[model samples]
Target: MVSSSSTPAAFVTGAANGIGEAVVARFLAGGYRVAMVDLDADRLRAAREKADPAGERTIEAVADVTDEQSVRAAISATVEAFGRLDAAHNNAGITSSGPNTHELELSAWQRTLDVDLTGVWLCMKHQLPVMLEQGSGAIVNTASIAGHIGYRNAAAYAAAKHGVVGLTKTAAIEYAPQGIRVNAVSPGPVQSDMLEASFERRGAAVRDWYYASSPTGRFASLEDIAHAVHWLASAEASFITGHCLSVDGGWIAQ
Candidate 1:
């Protein structure tokens, strides 16, 4: 085991980069042993190394959230390493390409749901069991402002995120009596490679539109979203459950 039973341990998916990476840092900084999971094995190791150069407080789990067996094994591995699971951030997801509903292929829709919606469920399927066995745990899933509102060209992405919100609420209720709390963080435009790529593909006009829509007039940094995830999974938010906190820089308020 990596640490004493008194030390908290956390599992985070999509942890190789972006928001997930930042969340791992937050957890580690808070003195939690962390399992950094991602599909990209190399990046995951590098991330773990960067966050814990002494290799004392973190482990890297290469996992595909869409694969049940992979997710199960990763969770098991984390428990084996850390001795217990106290929190989980189911953050592995991908955004759909901007294709109108009429232009979107069926495969694209299925792919988005597989990674964004079904993936979250699979992680929780395995994670919840561990948390239940431990008698307490916190889970924070990554949602989006799009989950709360319809986006013009992202039908599948929006639908999948909407499903995430529903799942968060239902799971929170079902698991609350078991001493587990489930919630979600809905981020708007966050500064990351993914958003930058979208801007590259769509040009300045779309980017300007995003800026204008946000009351902050700017995108959120990865740390902004990470902070929300960390707080939602912490003891500070003990009374909050079945809630979807928006870290959107005031985008949805408009």
Candidate 2:
């Protein structure tokens, strides 16, 4: 069903920086009212200002995605502000810095799953109810190449992302009949401030290795993944539910 209002609305988690920030900008550019949800209050505010300078179409929800109550409140606030939810992107996640699967601490594994897997689930839990009531919505989850394949040392992150993909598929199948389409974007290495910082710390050799890993010999820009996510949540992808669209630079193919 089309939105009752001429202006549609979106709620995006992890909207402070990187792909999340880019996604917010993309949605705003497309004329959608967006809720920018993130744990960093200052950064979230900065991002909202950058995306919607006039303060006409964006709301800042300073909530941690891992907390159930926080996630619920964020969604509630978004609905109260916008009147309805037309789309959501569960993009908040933390990567694991584990040394190896056998050497990883139990706490580390739990933390990764709590934020990456459970956080996405919690967002959907609240967002789905709103969409269900409206009988229309779209949801996009941020998976990763680790979800589809494997990441050498980041066992916990990979497992959590894999769970995200599974959850996306399950929800898609269950809600399609109700006019909600669910999908995921699995990105490989992306060109972002975080990745750039990693390069600075790890040196040129590490950067070259990442470049060589991708068949395209380069990392994806944040905009690339953001565009894929926006498209998945738009009407253009109405029939593309349960799909995990890869924004990798052909890395997983090899």
Candidate 3:
């Protein structure tokens, strides 16, 4: 059930920056036709241009994963552009903080779930049908350290990511018979623009703590998380499915 085409294609959400952006480059380097989706049209276009200045093998999709119609259209566009859909990365998500579950606002909770958990579902909702039709495909969801364990103030984000982990496993099981593999990548601490801003807000002390906590003594580079994701979609990981691969540099072990 491997792709017959010499060059396969991939659809990646949250592709404007961070790990998503890194994955876009990774797939391109692997000789893939990539459709990069992000909510930020400008940033996404910039990424698309930087990734493929010649306007070949890359499509910029400005779509929101949280909206069902938007998600469907984006997938459709990807297929139209690439002639087939072989892989997907449900990587778009938002971070939300609540003092605690009790104090968490209903709206905040709902939005977090909508973007992080339900968004992945929607992407699968649309992408699975295409993969099912093609009879083969792969998908990777970006879960987090919060999904595997507790992070005190991030109840809402944790809940949503945990849901993503469950969803990934469910899809993997259901689609195994049809040659589709669904998996997740959970990262503990990564180097991204978001982390920089978060640390700036949380102060140097907290930032330093995250670095020292990593057994490797530093935050994960964007490529660290991206490479794991790229592997899951490649032939090397053909036997791996429904698995939550932890690229946490031993943070999970601690």
Best by TM-score: 1
Report the poorest 10 consecutive residues by lDDT, candidate 3: 1-10
Model 1 per-residue lDDT tens digits across residues 1-254: 33349999999999999999999999998889999999999999899889999999999999999999999999999999989999999999998867789999999999999999999999999999888887889999999998999888999999999999999999999999999999999999999998998889989999888888889878899899988988998999999999999999888887
Query: lDDT of each prediction vs. the true structure?
Result: 0.93, 0.91, 0.91
- Measured against the true structure, the TM-scores of the candidates, in listed sequence, are 0.97, 0.96, 0.96
Query: How big is the RMSD of model 1?
Result: 1.6
TM-score of candidate 1 against the unseen true structure: 0.97
Q: Kindly give the stretch of ten consecutive residues in candidate 1 with the minimal lDDT sum.
A: 1-10
* Residues 28-104, model 3: lDDT tens digits: 99889999999999999999999999998899989998899999999888887777888899999887763777999
Order the candidate numbers by lDDT, best to worst. 1, 2, 3
**What are the candidates' C-alpha RMSDs?**
1.6, 1.9, 1.9
- TM-score of model number 2: 0.96
Superposition error at 162 for model 3 (Å): 0.6
lDDT by residue (1-254, candidate 2, tens digit) is 32367588999999999999999999988889999999999999999898889999999999998899999999888888888899899999887753879999999999999999999999999999889988999999999989998788789999999999999999999999999999999998999987888778778987899987888878899999989999998888878999999999888888
Give lDDT: candidate 1, residue 181. Answer: 99
Name the candidate that leads on lDDT: 1
| Candidate 1, position 113, lDDT | 99
**Candidate 3: where is the Cα deviation over 4 Å?**
1-5
Provide backbone clash counts, one per model: 0, 0, 0
